[model samples]
Target: MKAKVGMEVSWHLRMLLFISFASSFLNVSYAQTNNDYDTPAAPPPGLSNCNGVFLTYSFTSRDKEYPHIKNATAQAWAFKSSATIVNTGEYEVKAWQMFVGFQHKETLVSATGATIVDSDDFPVDASNGTTFAGGSQADLKTSIETAGDFTQISAQIDITGTQFGVKPPGVPMPSIIKLVNNGYKCPKATMRGSYNY
Candidate 1:
């Protein structure tokens, strides 16, 4: 009787240990799976925003006057950007200014197969060379009276450079544009200065 009782108690302890170990293993596996599923996705390149204002900018180079202006030492290039500003708050955005900064890079190859890289930064301004502004007090009040109201904005920068010349192979021009608002009202904020290209 004593031997049978001892065997029964040993079996019960063994079963309890097995159950505890299995429960711990299951919890660890579940934690790993949950973490894997909670990871976030990466954002797209060259897409950024500022205070509910989202901007999408891109750079492309081509010989607009190609073939027609054969043997031309230089070419014209265009840079463009657009934004969508949304009013998510109750207050209206009266008199808003959007400033864009650009960094231009040119990779030049000489007739002798020599290569040179040059870069410069400049601001995208209006025809009067002032920071781009929009939405008067009245316009803002009318347009953004309700939440979820939004407005569209755009900017362009045109430039001419010898780096666009096709005489030397592998010569190309590229640009990097960004928003330059130091978190202030109009006239106080300024974009990057112009470059000679």
Candidate 2:
């Protein structure tokens, strides 16, 4: 009778240990699933042009985990710009050029000291208008900034474009081209204001 009781107790303890281990594994899996990365937000408003072309610029930064770095979280920033151009004119446009500029500022704070990094006038080109129709959809450009580790990061992006219609073979270039504006400036405007993270 004593031997049977000892065997039953041992079996129960093993079963309990197995159940505990399984439960812990399930809880960890659930937490990881719930903490998936988030999608980026939409670009700000007022980044359109007078010629029915819309430009959007967005910046995002987040904390990332690095297993190799102890007691340190990596900070990363991403920048993107997209342009949608609609001819909306009576005549088809021959060519177009989109100009984009970006600036990034970063500050790092650690036990030693604080370090700052500034980058200005980084140019990105996204120009294409080989054959544009009156109501056709066109993508002008897309660009992404580098990511790194910093305590604070901020960025500014500017976008502008010029459209050119079909000109006679002998006509000068500038005379046949049209400049697009967004009420703020002529042929140039702010696609995205200063964004901080």
Error of 2 at 28 (Å): 5.7
Residue-by-residue lDDT tens digits, candidate 1, 1-197: 99999999999999999999999999988998896668753432322423333333222344453344554444533322232222333344454443333223332221111111121223222222222334232123322454333332222222323233443333332232223344533222212222111
Q: Tell me the deviation in Å of residue 175 in model 2.
A: 23
Off by over 4 Å in 2: 1-29, 32-39, 45-53, 57-97, 101-188, 191-197
The collision pairs in model 2 are none
> Using Cα atoms with residue i matched to residue i, what is each candidate's TM-score against the true structure?
0.31, 0.27
Model 1: per-residue Cα lDDT at residue 115: 12
RMSD of each: 15.0, 18.5
Question: Number of clashing residue pairs in every model?
Answer: 0, 0
